[model samples]
Each structure stands twice: as C-alpha cells, then as structure tokens.
Target chain A: MTGVVSPMAAPAALRGAGAWKPAELLFWTLPVIGWFAFPENLPLLTQIAITALFALSLDLVLGVAGMVTLGHAAFFGVGAYAAGMLPAYLGIGDPLLGLVAAAAAAALAGALTSPLMLRGSGLSQLMVSVGINAMLYEAANKATEVTGGVDGLPGVENTPLFGMWSFDLYGRTAYVYAVVVLLLLFWMARRVVRSPFGVSLRGIRLNAARMPALGVPVNRRLAVVWTLAAAYAGVAGALLTQTTQFVSINVLGFDRSAEVLLILILGGAGHLYGALVGAVAYMSIHHLLADIDPEFWQFWIGLIFIVVVLFARDGALGAAARIRDLIRNLILGRGASR
Target chain B: MTILFDGIASGMLLFLISSGLSVTLGLMGIINLAHGAFAMLGGYVCVVALDRYGIPFPVAVLMATLSAAAAGVALERLVYRRLYGAGQLDQVLFSIGLIFVSMALARWLFGPQPQPIRLPGWLQGQVQLPWIEIGVYRAFLIVLGLVVAVTLHRAVGVTRFGARLRAAVDRPAVARGLGIDVDRVFVVAFAIGSALAGLGGAVGVELLGLDPSFPLRYLVYFLIVVVVGGSGSFEGSLVASVLIGIFDVAGKYYVPQVGSFIIYTVMVVMLIVRPQGLFGRPSP
Candidate 1:
C-alpha cells in the first residue's frame, strides 16, 4: 500500500508515448502501419483493439477511480448480448444503433450495481463483484430466449460503416472499424481523465474518506465514472460482436473479466495507454505461447502473472518507463535535460 | 425436514472449508486465493491414498491433512514469508499463481476428471431420524465439522496463542518486548489453517465435486463464507455457513431454476446489511 505505485499514478512515459503528439506520431498511426505490416493478422489485431478498449474502461474504475472490480465483464457481456441481439433477433443490423443500445444497457447495469459495490471493503467488495458477475452469467445463461444460452447468439449481421463498407472476411473493414472506435473512445477517455471531475475521481481514489471533507461527493462521482466506464466497455463488447458477428456465453465468464484485468495490470494501469499497450503485448504473447502448447498455456500465463506482480512494479509499461528514465538520467544527468 | 438436515450437513462442510481461510484472511490480511487449491490438494491426496495405496478412509484423511499442512509450512517458509509485507493484491496474485501451478500439476499427475473414490459400507447408507434421514457420511461430516470448529474457536478465542496473537496484532512492540513468540504463533496458526482446509477438502470432495478446476469453481463459495460470515469471528462464520447452507440447499430443491440467484442474493443482501460482515473486525 505504501511503496507500490497506486493504480492512479498516470505513467508519464505512456502518456507522452501513447498520445497523438508529433514526437509520438506512431501512437496514432501504428494501427494504419500495422494494417500494412501484418496484413494476414488483421483479425488478431482487431481482437487486440477491442480487448484494449475493454481494458481501458477498467482503468477508469480500477486505476483512476480505485475500484477493484472482478465483475467488469458484466458490462462487456451485456453490451455484446444487447448488440448481437439487435442483428440476430430484431433484424436491425445498424452498427451505430447497436453500439448505442449496448452502451446504454451496460451503463444502466453499472449504475444499478455501483451502489452495491460502495457498501463493502476489500474481501466483501471482491466477493460482491464476483457475485454480481456470476449472477449476470447465470442471467445470460438462463435467458436463452434472448441470449441463445450455451449455443451462443447466432446470425448477427453488420450493416457496414455508415452504410458504406460491409464487414469482410479478410478483416479489412473490421480492423479499420475497430481501430476507429478504439481511437475515438481512447480520446474521449483522455478527455475524461484530464477534466475536473477526473481529478476528483483521483482524489477519491487516493483517499475517499478525506475527499468528502474536501466537499467532493464521493459516491455520486464514483457512480458516474463507473457508469461511464461501463458504457465504454459495452461499446467495446459491441465492437467485438459487430466485427466478429458472433457473441458467446464465454463473454460473460469469470475468465474474460480476469484476463482483461490482467491485461490492464500488465500494461501498467492508470495511464490511458496502459490498456492498449498491455492488451497488445498480452494478447500477442498469449497467442504465441498458446500456439506452442494449447493444453498447458495457462501454466505459462500464470507464471507470467506472478513474475509481473513480483518483479514489475508498474507492469511492462511502468517498467519500461523506469528503464527509459534510468537511461535518460545516465545520459543527460538527473533533472538536467528535461 | 430432510432438506433442513441436508442443509445443516452441507453447512457444516462449508464451515470446515472456510474457517481456515477466514482466520488467515482476518489475522494476516493475506488474500490467498490458493486456499482452495490446498483444499483441492487435500481431496486428491485423500483419493490417491484411499484408492491406490489401499489406506482406510479415516487414516487417509489424517494423512491428507498432514501432507497439506506440511506443504503449507514449506510454502510459508519458501514463498509466503517473503510476501507477508507485500501489497494485498500482490498476495492474491501470488497465491493465484500457486493455485494455477497446483492445478496444472494435478492434471498432469492425476489426469482431467475428478478422481474416483468408493465409500465404505458403514459410511454409505443413511440413518433415519424422527422426522428426517441423513447419510452416514453426512453425519461423519457434521461431527468432524463441529469438532474442528470448536477446537479452532477454543484455540483462537480462549488459548494462550489467541492472547499472544491479539497482543501482537494490537501492539507488536509491546508484545515482542514481553517475549511473545509472535512469529511462531503465526506459523502454527497458518499451518493449522491449511490442515483444516485440507481436511475439509478431503471430506467434502464427494459433496462439493472435486476436480482439477476445483479451486476456481468453489472459490466464490469459500470467499462468501468468510466475508459474509465476518472475518475474525468463529461464531459469525458458523452462523453464516448454516444460513447459507440451508438457503443454497433449499433453493436447489425448491426453486431449481434460481438456485445460484438465491446464493448471490444472500451475499448481496449480507454485504448491504453488514459491510464488515456479520461480526467482522472494524478495519484498522
């Protein structure tokens, strides 16, 4: 609690490196460059983009707002179901409308559940979050008429980008669509984290008890941010459903929540870009390792998780910044060149 | 009436399974997710000893518990010792990693499905009561659960170790000045807790359904028992488990469609009603 970097310490390295600045030109253009470089891996890249967005939403609560949620997948699953249902059952393939409905649905779920989270501490909170997620999973599983249950909701057809470009098998449109959505959400998140309200969320995260004395309405702020984050996560889930054209019960599983949380931590939470970088690195490494031995990959991933928590204080992004700072200080002298 | 009996029987096992975790969680503030893994290990150990080596069931339970206790001691010395002062999340992550390692090892060694075990004749049949009937194994479980819970409660609530732990937790410097072996107490308590978990796992395997994924599957249930019952309170955990056990059992029997909902509802309602748990210690 004392020495460990609080999840809210915005990593200056990633903020500088990930932002769309002239020096960090690659941050904005990487997807475009990646589109050209890894032509065959568009589908994987699209998945990475969607997962990155989901992790980003978690950072708002876990990092910026200091809520340790194990049930964040509830929003994602809700979004996926809501979005997929439109095209599958309602015959409405309008991607934008589906995305809105998904976000709205998830936001409502978050608003309702956020109050339940506010009552407990540590283990109680952890159990509640897990409990809520499990409840949602059960709800989704039982609501077979809508969710299609174990078989998963099928027949989701995308209406194309603004009614122009349809989703293609080569994943060209899907990749572009996912990237655009991620960038928009990433920019919006950046705005939210830098605003006055975001700073209040930070104050609450650092010390919620003291914040109310300073006149910050802690519960309201937390609920608001939580709802917003849920909306963002829902959109990400919708993006996945829209591009992949499928939604499964696995979306609501504990594994999905855990993996996204791990990805956020791996990227070094707090910073907006931590999610994106963490998602890319984790997914890629997982992809590589999983391919090597499908049966035993969880062992390696678990090992990675342990090693990351033990050795890497801030995760890969956090560690990378420290290394960069060390090199800069050695070359330019401490506090000399900046 | 039968449902009530079954609920009480199941509740007893829940108490046994969670008491160790509840103690360690409150006293040490260590979020050891691997707690269930130790329970799973105990089950597998009991199964192996009973099936392959032809050990009697009761003896095998003792062996399984001791083995798990030994593992806990080794783990405490080797890994957990370094982590005593670490962040709470770090502890959770570390223990989770350990559980995953154990799970993989179990799969590699024992293969995928739940290890098979056959109950002996005396422990297999049901005994009819005035209004209801209960399995002999369930009766054994209730006895085992009561004995362990009472022993633990007495040991932690009335014994010298309890006083020493309280002193240490309250005023470490003063306790140390008084020559209390705080470290030894911690080690002993941790070992006992692990043994209890192992014993519970071994005994409850048939009821809870053990397999390689045992830890992950039953983690929520264990946590619910500890947190909902209120950490650091033996009485609290006992009460919570009985209530939960009855609700869960009765839910499945009566409202087959919404069984999980019943449990989740209890957890949510409990948290709202008592955020610190029914008898949880006020946060330090």
Candidate 2:
C-alpha cells in the first residue's frame, strides 16, 4: 500500500497553472468553450461523462474506501430499474423523483448488506457480492410481472426535466444534464475526501487493527462509506436509464461489475480524475476496436491489458500523464527562464 | 418423496464440486476461481470423447479427469506459483483474468451453444423404489458422490499423505522445517482438488447443462457452499450442500419469487457473524 497515492492528498493541483487560479473563472469559461466549439461531439462526450461518474462511484469503494465489490452493479441495476419502472408502472413521471428513488433504493440495500461485508476480507466479500448480484439478476428474470423479465420493461416515457427539458435524440438536454451532474458529484467527492471523516476512512484502509485500537469504530465507518458509494452508483444508473430510456437485465450482469472494476484499477485508484480518463479511453478504444474487427476485438483488448499491466501499471491515464510530462519538458526546454 | 430423492441427488453433485474448493482454499490459501473453469473443461472433454470419438463413458470420464488434472498442474506452475505471496486482491483479480481466458478458449473451441452428450441407455431410465422413483443416472450420481466423500474423509483422516497434507495446511512453515516437500505437496493438493472438480463437472454435466458459461455462473454458487460449510472441511461441505439443496428446493417450490436470494442472504448472515465458516476453526 505504500508508495501509492492516498485519496487524502487532494491538495488542489490548481496553484496557478500559470494564470488560471479562480474556480469560478474556469467553471464558466470551460463550459462556454466546450459547448460552442464541440457541438457535434456532445453526445459522445455525454456518454463518457456518465460512465466516468459511474466509475468514480466505484472508486470511492474500491480505491479510496478499500472495498473490493464485484456486485456494485446491484445498485446500478436497481437505479435503472427504478427509474424505468416507476414511470411505466406507477405513473411517477417526474424525472427528479425517479432519480432520487433509484439512489434511495440502492442506498437502502447497501445499508442492509453493509454489515455482511464488514467481517469478510477481499475474496469473501467478492464472493458474497457476486452471489447477491446473481440472485438479484435471477429474481429479475423470474419476476416477469414486475420486471418484464428478459424482454425488458419498455415504453418508459420520460417527462421533461422540470416539465420543460425533454430528452432529444441529439442528446442536447441529456448531455448537458449529465455533464452538470458529473461536475457536481466530482466537486462533492473532492470536498468529502478532504474532510475528517475521509481521514478516518483512510486510516481504516491503511491499518484496520491499529485504527480500531485507536477508537475508529472501523466496521461502522466501512458500512457508511459503502452505503454512500452505493448511493452514488445508484444515481449514475438512474442517469443511464433516463438518458437512454431503456433498461436491460445486462445492467446487473457480471461483465458490468468486472468492467467497472477494471476501469477503476486501470485509471489509478486513488486519483480522482483517473476514472474519467480510464472510462473515456476504455470505451473509445473498445468501440473503435470492435468496429474494426468484430470477432477478434478481444484479442487486441487483451493485448492492451497485458501491456498496461506490465508497462503502465497505473493505466492509460497514468501513461498519458507521463507522456504529457515528457512533452512539456521537451517543449519548455528547461526550468523557467530567469 | 421423488422430489426429496432428486434434492439429495443434486446435493451430492454440489458436495463433490465444493469439497475440492474447500480443501485447496483451506490448505493453500489460494482462491482459485478457475476451479470451475477446470470443471467445465473436464465436462467438455468427456463430452467430446464420448460423443465425437466413440469412447466408452467410463473411459472417457477417466481421460477427462486426468486431462483436467494436467491442466490444474499447469496452472499451479504458471499462474498460481507466482501468486503465492501476493495479497488477496491480486489473487482474486488474476484468477478472474484466468477464468476469462479459459472460458474464451472453450467458447472458441466449442462454439457458444450447449452440447448434450447422451447418457448411456443404462443411465437413461428411472428406478422405482417402494416410496419413490428416481432417475437411474441420478441415483448413480448420488451413490458415486457419497462414495467419493466417504473415501476422501477416510483418506484425509487416516492416510499418511493426508496427514502430510493436513500438517501442511495447519502449519506450513513447521512442516517445511520438518523436511516435508511443501512445494510438491501444494502442487499435488491443487491437482487432486481440481481433479475432483473436473470429475464433479463430468458427472454433474447431465444435471446442469454443459456450456462455456457454466464456470462463471457456478463459481459463486460453490463459493457460497464453501462459506456456509466452512472451507477445508469435507464433512461440512457435504452437510451444507444437502442443507442448501433442501433450502433451495423449498424456496423454489413455495416462495418462487425469492428462490436463490434466500441462500445468498443466509450466506451473507453467516459471513458476517462467523467469518471462519460454520464448522471451520479459525485459521491461525
């Protein structure tokens, strides 16, 4: 665990990037530039944005909180099902309430299962989570009346946000909404990582026995962190359902859980922005590779994984950072001229 | 009564698969997720030998079992050997990767669809008892599984190799200092454990359809058995498997809505309250 970057080291990397220091200035200026310059890329960017949030939510447990969950998709699936079904079955047309309900349902489940996870180590926890997810997926498959089973619950008509912003195919409203949510969550997560509670969580992750001996109440803190992470995952799932307007059983599948875990590890666990970079890079490369050769895409992806594991231990984002540093040095030629 | 017979039959199959996993995990501290993958490989081999190559069923089963044992030995040498000193997280991730590679290879070799290797005519019919009639194959499976379980218990409790394996499991460092071939013992331990998984897969394939996805799907089910029975205890797995079989049948028959989740919930509760497993003594 030593030599790895701890989540508590968020010392705001914005100490005068030469000129940009004001948070308000960057917030306003970047959005205007992005919206005006890349109007055509908004849809793709939006998908990446939501996925990035999903990955970040996973990192809160896997990376920061040190909980290796293989069934984080349980929360994600619950959120999607809640968002899709509440409107279709119960006539709750309000998008806001659907999202809230999705997160709340997943949070409740996370809270209930938190005690189960508190005692087990990595493999034990992973097995329990996998079993839980599989059972849920089977239940969803069997509950045809409620879930519509494998055929999926369709005809989910989304009421416009605030009764105004209707989701469009071009993803104009969905993209903006998703991006805004990601930014807000990112900001909140950053603040949380800097708090005293986050410090205690870090202590528990580092040395559980020592921390409990120091009066940390390690088990309870684990449950709290796990529940919070599940809530975030639930919200991300809700966003996916709302944006796509379709919910499938695959959302709770093993592949979903494994891919999310891979994305987090590939992105460098403790680094906040690594998840975004990992998700965007992974999805983009996967899409490109699949399009180029449908049948043998896995071969190339496997090769990429091996290279990343061997050479770039931190992942694509870490490799990119190294390349960027090299280029900066090459261009700048030396330290700042006197 | 027929339902009860069927439950017992299925419970035996579960016991066979889970007992091996329990031993290796208890002894070596290696979480071999690929154990099920080995089982699937064995099932496919048996299917290929019996159906495609016209081999006798018993001979095909033996060949499949040995082939799986060879594969297990190879895995122990190549992947697991490096992972001995690694932490639990790395072991889990690496084994997951191994599962993926093995499954992809199986799918590539034998397409995605499930294959049926017809049971011999002798195993095709049902046998009637005074109270109930059960599938002949199911009866054979239950008998075979019981024999293996009893043999394993006696071997581990009484035999010299079993004593050495047990000593290694209980205290590896001490065993090594006392001149035991600890490395060779681990290799044989994994090989035997995985061979049982292979045999279980071959025998149980008729009950649970043989497919590439079988390993990934049933991996956690066996893990639950291990957790509930307490890892490393063959008797515990046997008892737990029957208990789970009964519980699973009851859940499905009555509260069909929450069929599998009941077992999972029980596992979660057991894990939280007793991390050492139900009958397992806490590892030192």
- TM-scores of the candidates in the order shown: 0.92, 0.87
Model 1 chain B: which ten-residue window has the lowest total lDDT? B22-31
Pairs with steric clashes in candidate 2: none
- Leading candidate by DockQ: 1
Q: Which residue ranges in model 2 land beyond 4 Å of their true spot? A: A1-45, A296-338
* Predicted candidate 1 versus true structure: per-residue lDDT over B248-283, tens digit per residue: 999999988775777877888888888888888767
Candidate 1 Cα outliers beyond 4 Å, as residue runs: A1-20, A314-338
lDDT of 2 by residue, B223-248 (tens): 88887788677888888887877777
Error in Å for residue A228 of model 2: 0.9
lDDT tens digits, residue span A1-338, model 1 = 11223346555643453344442344667798899999999999999999999999999998899888888898999999999998888899999999999999999999999899887767778778889988888777877787888899888997877899988889999999889989988888887777667777888988989998977789888888989999998999999899889999988887788788778877667876678778888899889988998777788777766766666654334453454344334432442121
TM-score of chain A of each: 0.88, 0.83
**DockQ (CA atoms), all models:** 0.56, 0.33
